[model samples]
Target: MAILIGTRDGVYRTATVPVEDAEQVLDSGDVPRVQTFPELDGVFAATKTGLYRSTDEGQTWKNLNVPQEEVYSVVASPDSERLYAGTHPAHLYVSIDDGDTWAELEGFQELPSRDEWHTPRHRNEAHVRSLGVHPEMSDRVIAGVEVGGVHVSDDQGETWTERRDGVHDDVHHVLVLGADEYVASCGDGLYRTRDAGQSWTSLDTDLDHRYFREAFELDGRLYAAAARSSPGTWSGEGGADAILVESTDSGETIETVSYPGGPAEVILAWTAVEGDVLAGTNDGRLISRDEDGTWVDAGMIPAGIRSLEVC
Candidate 1:
């Protein structure tokens, strides 16, 4: 199996799974995320430059002709033709034609707290950092904006309901665990809700490290990647004090997984393929844990990886 890697510089593909070396497949500037849509025979790349799509399994790409700014996240509904894209400067758009065209979900910008959705760094502009969709509910869509808040739309992207009742506003990623259960990773800590987004409870309040980048589930365990502080404080000397945590009780209690000795760095992205959980670190290290519970270096990329997906 081959895995697609979206990095700070470009997009690449490993020679093979349990990869040893990778080759740059697309030279798109700063690919933050890459996803595959089998329904449209498409491989989509969301980059700092713009959104691009390839129907030929990433051999070549064509601009979808939408979103001139950085597309932070992109997702497609399981049971509908609706496709969503979240961009920097905090905007949301929906595509019904497999990304051929899109319509801005204007209602998202009219939220009551929209004026307060601003980042603390880099021009004080927030971005839609992540998105989540439930396969069981076609109309249910969730968006996570960096330094903003998490919002959900039950009627597709037509309208949204924003809430910061429990979770912090500096959201990075959100995942629908099951049904109404949702988990959010934020700059403050990790939070989860058993009753959908109505209410949430902090799961990582006891952990000193607050910054989290990504979370995913593999087999029957929930895995999260965390850092000691924000990326701005991370340096090359020691990298970030990054670690991986596992929760067996669905984010209720977590235990730190052992790591190989090295200067700590944040694991910004994770993915599971063929029952193997893989992580990409801020120092461009592709690490994996074996059945024996040992962390081993799988491979490395030229630049820090932002996202990983099987294709």
Candidate 2:
């Protein structure tokens, strides 16, 4: 087994599973997202430059032909041969030949809010920050567009319905916990829905800062991280005043989780393997908690990490 870390510089791999063993395997440039497809026996890196694939773990990689210049995220459909890529300017693409070639999902751009989808940084455009696919319902796919709100498609990518009621529009990530349950981490706060996006309830309304990015579920417990504000205004050696939050009862209640070294950085990536949970910070710090709940430094990456996955 190996842990794959996608960083601002490149992709790193470590079969040792411990952070200390991680080493750069592919220098494809600014890997914003990395994912593993066990059914295909390979891994993929959605880089700032292009999309790459590796079959022999991470020892080798090949660039795939994608219409977009920047692939921000890659996800595998339940059907092994089908794959999807979310790109800059917030466009979605589908690949049926395992990334060999991609076709633009034109229907995505026809949403009613397309004209209003603009990022704070670029102002002229936005990005597909995150995507979630139902485990049992392969036809359903939900995409979280930065500053664009959430869009749900029940017939694969053929059609879409935009839904932003009750939740913040600046969605960062969407976690599909079940067929009807979803948890969203956004620039405003965390939101949960049990009616398949028909309605939503904000969970972290009382938080001082609500720039949440990612979330994970392990052993019936939910974990997430938040920054005092957006990264655009973050400063000081401590980075954003980021904090970790946990929920044991499916997000009905949440409690702050303090790290052993104190909260000094922003956590952008999270993953769990064999019941062990790990988190990576935006300041090149990697750490994990012991069984007794003591946080320990794992190791360091060459640059800030954007995504993490186990293969």
Candidate 3:
């Protein structure tokens, strides 16, 4: 297996941990997400320039040519019959013929709160930073928009319903745990909704750190990380002041854990390879848990990692 690391500069591929050599596979700038779907043929990278696909384990890439230059997120339909791409300015597009062509999901534009989705940090525009679908709900699509809110579509992408009322607006990623359950990591807090976004519960109300980027689940345990503040405040001597937490009961409770880059570097990406849970940090460190349950630094990439994938 090869580890694909999506960084600020590009995507890098390596064969083993403590990486002796890492090759830059795709030069797509500012990769926000690198993902692989079981039903899909290759890995997909969503970058600021465009969306790209690599079939040979990141050896080569072909631009999917999403209409918007800044493709923030991409996901395949549960049955792999359709592909969805979310872009900056917070728009949604769908492609049925692989990546050859795409059409806008105009329903997303009709949201009642579409005009209020802009944030000054993103030049008064937001992006669909995350997309999710469950195997049992093939016609459903969940979108997490940064500076906006989470929205759900029942008939693929043809129509959407706003589910952002109680959740934080600066959404980053949404993990679909089941047909009706999801965990959303946001710029302000982490949230969970077991009733398909009908209502939400703030899982981070007891924690001091509120800024979250992503959440992962492995072996029935949910893992998440958070910073004391947003990225702009991460440059101080204290660094990110981040903490990693794990929940075995599906976010009902959590316990803090220490890592190699703790309190300084925040883990932004996660993937499992060969039964090992590996995480990439915003400071360019690749760390993994060993058989003894100890977190160790695996290697270092030149640039901060935005996403990770194993192929």
Candidate 4:
């Protein structure tokens, strides 16, 4: 058995695993979004061409015609046999009958002023950076656009509404635990909305001028990754660096963890296992400063880690 991985270098690597392990991978390839659907006894990865599925743990592959240029984010529907993906240059694709075929989500694409794509430093349409699916409601999904803020989908990806009622204009990451509970990472800091995004309050905690990047829920607490703001910025840290913060009471209070990195740059994108949190830093290293206070440098991935999904 083996686990498959695709890299930005345009190569796919496979890792061998024991048969006793239920989640073993036999192979992997040049895919962007990796997802495991055990019921189908297969793994799916989305790339520039389309979606690929492997019935035997990625030993071989078949294409599922969901054509697009750059598939940046992918999500699975819990309510039915469907898949959703967000692509570069502003496009959302939905597959209703499994991953075999897809169509451009007209409702999501038809959103008002959505055609104006913009990145952190560039402008175009809305470039979705990250995506989230509500835990309690499978039909509810949200996307974090680089410059367009937050977008929410109440009926899967069929329709999307801007979730900017109380959010900043630039949103990078979003996590929705329930209908009334959502967490967002923006250019300035972190904010949480308890009233279904109708009203929001910024968590007035200290983060050393870091722009909140990624967030995850572990042990009933929320942990977030924040990078120091770029030069000439005055949000958190004054340079292009990053750090981590943990919150136990939703978004009320936070505790900052001081990881040993320098003034140059920093990013903490990780692959979270059952009990392990492995992160790849921007400085070309893979290390983890876990909640248990035992920092471990597992080795290195030698690649820029964009985000980590616990699959």
Candidate 5:
């Protein structure tokens, strides 16, 4: 299959399409900040209103209804039949039939709160930032709230348990590196929980900055992106200069993948292409790392990207 690349500055920019004009879409009125799915055959993009699907390797896109809610993230269960999406107003949207239709997961409206629920710094916004769905157990899903710590749903979102024990409550992202083992990007930095969400032990001590953008594993190693925002570097340019940290044993130990460039750009929204393990930088660049943890520039992508994932 020949890959054809296109360019878009903000919206649907590039397409490595085939001549057949299969399913290729990236257009206006569509805010696809992030895309990922359990079914690697299709890339599910998280848009402002709903999710989009592309079966033909992003050659084209089709919208799925999920109006009025901002889709922060989406994940396909390892079980295949179940799909999960986290959206604003703190709702865990679920779909049982591929990417057809979605329903609000039961009891999603019942997450515990301090009566006045809001994000730590940005009190106006309250949303689930990340989701850690256990690969072996579909019923057990962990959700990271803006500043409300982590919430666990044992019955597939039917009922929830706030498992912030031994872990930071201001959780941004939760990644299950293995069965019953987890890691969270939280207020106190990187923390790991061995027995599901029951308890945790902090990793990478005193790495200040509560903002942990995303987490994923490559070649059996766990990786996460962090940024230190400032005027010229952070917020967008220099402010976002952060260290890309990795762990060999489910976050037991830490190391830096920091090379020449910094990760101020939203790293998670970019697609982590399986072959090159490409990571999209917020500064409009595509970088890839091999199994040996070496970094090299691959290309450039759209600006204002959210994160990267494989289909």
Candidate 6:
């Protein structure tokens, strides 16, 4: 097995943890996500430059040439008939020919809330930070925008409905749990919607850490990490002052867990390998849970890891 670490610099592939002999597979800048679809041939990397795919594991890559330069997220349709690419400036594109060509999903720009999606921190522009689809809902598409909000498409990106009314607008990622359920990690708070975004429940209402980047689930348990504030306050003496929380009964209740880099390095990405949870930190640390349910340091990469994929 190979672990593909998507870092701020590029994507690195290593066969073993502790990452002693990691290789830079793709030089694309600032990979925000690395994903794989069962219908697709290989791994896909969403980078600052473009969307790329690697057929032979992570050794070499070919740019998919998404129309937008800064591809933030990529996912294949449930039937593998269409490929979606979300990019900076908060635009959506689709490819019907297995990424050979692309076309902008213009309906996304028609959203009434599009004008208010900009954030000054991100150069007054937002990016589609996350895209999700469940196999059961083949025609549904869920998009989480960094400075915008969560939006839903019922006809596979042909039209969109604004589902950001109750949820925080600064969504970092959205984990699609089921056809009608999702957990959104946002800058203000973490939210859960059971009715396909008709309404939302704040999962972090009672927590001190409001800023969340992502959430993961393994063995019927949900794991999430958050910082006291945003990234700007992470460089303080206490670092990010982050905390890792686990919820066995979904997000109704959570308990704090101590890890190798507590209150300093926040876990930003997660992926499962051999039934064990592997997490990547904002400080470039890789930790994994052992049989004893303890997280141990696996190793570190050159740059902070934004995402991870196992192949």
Residue 246 of model 6, lDDT score:
91
Task: For residues 211-274, write the lDDT of model 4, one tens digit per residue.
Answer: 7665667557777767667434523443455666667898688886655443344554544555
- Residue lDDT tens for model 1, 112-201: 888888865947888888887877776888888887888888888888898667889999888777767888999989999877678999
lDDT, candidate 2, 59-131, per-residue tens: 8889886888788877777777678889888899998887778899999999999999996586578888777
User: For this target, which candidate reaches the highest lDDT against the unseen true structure?
Assistant: 3
| lDDT, model 6, position 55 | 90
Question: In candidate 6, which residue ranges exceed 4 Å CA deviation?
Answer: none
Q: Candidate 4 — what's its lDDT? A: 0.61
Please give the ranking of all candidate structures by lDDT, highest first, separated by commas. 3, 6, 2, 1, 5, 4
Q: How would you encode candidate 6's per-residue C-alpha lDDT over 50-150 as one tens digit per residue? A: 99999989999999999888999998998999999999989999999999999999999999989998988989999999999999999999999989999
Cα RMSD (Å) between model 5 and the true structure?
A: 4.5
> Alpha-carbon error at 303 in model 6, in Å?
0.8
**Model 3 — which ten-residue stretch has the worst lDDT?**
17-26
Q: For residues 51-78, could you state the per-residue lDDT of candidate 3 as single tens digits? A: 9999998999999999999999999997
**lDDT of all predictions:** 0.81, 0.83, 0.94, 0.61, 0.61, 0.93
Error of 4 at 44 (Å): 4.0
lDDT of 5 by residue, 1-311 (tens): 32222222223334331112212245533342444544445666665565666677666777766643566567777677777888766677888887677888758667556343475465465677777676678678788876667778878777888777677666667777766777787645777877877887878675644456557776677777776532234653344667777777777677876643564453543234535455655555556676677876665544444454443
